[model samples]
Target: MFQKIQRFFDQMIVMRDARGGTEISLELATAALLCEVVRADHSIAESEIVAMEAMLKRRFSLDEQALDELMELAREESEAAVDHYQFVRLINEHCSFEQKFELVRAMWTLAYADGEIDPLEEARIRTLSTLLFLSHSDFIRAKFAAKPE
Candidate 1:
């Protein structure tokens, strides 16, 4: 059975519109998930940071200040959290499948941005894909979309 959700991905996606109400935030949850992937290999890379910032700006239309704030909040949340349930719930609620596809692609991008895929990073993506309810084909597609040549 699916768990009932009470929140959204912030005002950006607004999972509350017509469907429900806003209970939390937008960038915070998504960014936390990205932060998790960054920490997967236990070493943050310059390339991964660059890729994440670039994608966040493009996707959320966040300026420098907002981007920095979001990243900081995400880092804090990721550090304090023991699981991915909250972030995954928000994404599944607020984002469309296509959006989730892009998000998964972004995860893959961040994972390989350092020009290598650590097993831990790969494992996180795999587990996250399932939690996000993404199909196997979509998962493979997203991986290929962000894979380094």
Candidate 2:
């Protein structure tokens, strides 16, 4: 599964390079997964877009131009993706437990950005939590941590 993902990301890199776009990185993978959350409900909300931009900028410390490029690349990759395993695999390889926990929090936060969580959005996050090897309790914790007051 991961080998297939590696090949896909490799092709993505080559395609992005040929277009003179920013190279793929862990940041891009993370961003793309967040994009997946945004697209999960089949209705893109401006608030979710804003939340994703803010979260990505703060997390990656990317400047405006770089952030824009990354978002575009992420969106394209998210759309073209065959599955979420690629993004999750890279993150699992690189991130610590705390980092993965925070990522789940971020996904929850994005899911609630529009003031409600669609079932589809929650389902996506649940799938991600399992893929990330998070405990069921930790998944609930992350959801509560990111829930708007």
Candidate 3:
């Protein structure tokens, strides 16, 4: 467990050396936000997990191994975080409006993955959208775009 934790934190170095610094950190930040959405409902559904994994994979172009590590690191980061500002700051600094919108959409998808939207989940996404400097229109648009058919 200790070694795992050490390796998890070491991901920054490994990923930075392997890829580049900003990309991996951005991925971590994005994943942490997704983790927040996953936990917003206070229930971790399997569908939510699957949705998160798929979104992360698609967004980051991560293979299974990297995806798994990112998911684990993000979960730990989210749990340890005192607030969302750190993650949001990193994302806002690095991501464009389109990228932020995509992230909000993914959050909505995760919120709806359990077959329903929880109030807490909605609130979480709303707050995140605002923090990401997105307008109400953007929020609503993403919500609808991610709404299940």
Candidate 4:
């Protein structure tokens, strides 16, 4: 009986650690924020989704299956989240200034994917860019850098 109890305790410890494990990387968190930006306008257009998938694949060097899996996981988490704090906290903890700037660019890229950036999308990007500690200059730079040619 004591051995069974000990085994149960050990299992509990393992489960606790596993539950606390980091499921999303900084890049994935950034991608999730961009996903939120794209969805902010109440329209997830095919162009936006395609641009997001392409960006994720190129930036992360992920194969199609891996990119799809990441997007699915990110979508689930982003949808389940109540606010942007979870993503902001992850970015704060794991990203550098340059990386954050790049994330903003990625968000801009996703926003422009539909050919016109909606007002809500712009607002969301501005709010999230500030939350990510990007300066206005950096934000503008990112926007230009991600602009479609």
Scored by lDDT, model 1 comes in at 0.80
Error of 4 at 145 (Å): 2.1
Candidate 4 wrong stretches, greater than 4 Å: 1-22
Writing each residue's lDDT as its tens digit, candidate 2 over 29-136 gives 899889999999999999999999999999877778777877987999899787887778878888899999999999999999999999999999999999999999
Q: Candidate 1 vs candidate 2: which has greater lDDT?
A: 2
TM-score of 3: 0.84
**On residues 1-149, what C-alpha lDDT tens digit does candidate 1 reach at each position?**
01212222334443332223423365677888888999999999999888899988887888786777667767887887778877788788878888888888999999989989999999999889888899899989999998777
Error of 3 at 148 (Å): 1.1
**Candidate 1 weakest ten by summed lDDT:** 1-10
lDDT of 4 by residue, 1-149 (tens): 45743432343211111234535555556667978998899999999989899888887777676677668767876776677876787787767898889888988988989999899998999999999888888888988998889
lDDT ranking, best first: 2, 3, 1, 4
TM-score of 4: 0.80
Worst-scoring 10-residue span by lDDT in model 3: 13-22
Q: Model 1 reaches what TM-score against the true structure? A: 0.83
Note the Cα lDDT for every prediction shown: 0.80, 0.85, 0.85, 0.77
lDDT of 1 at 113: 92
Model 1 alpha-carbon miss at residue 126, Å: 0.5
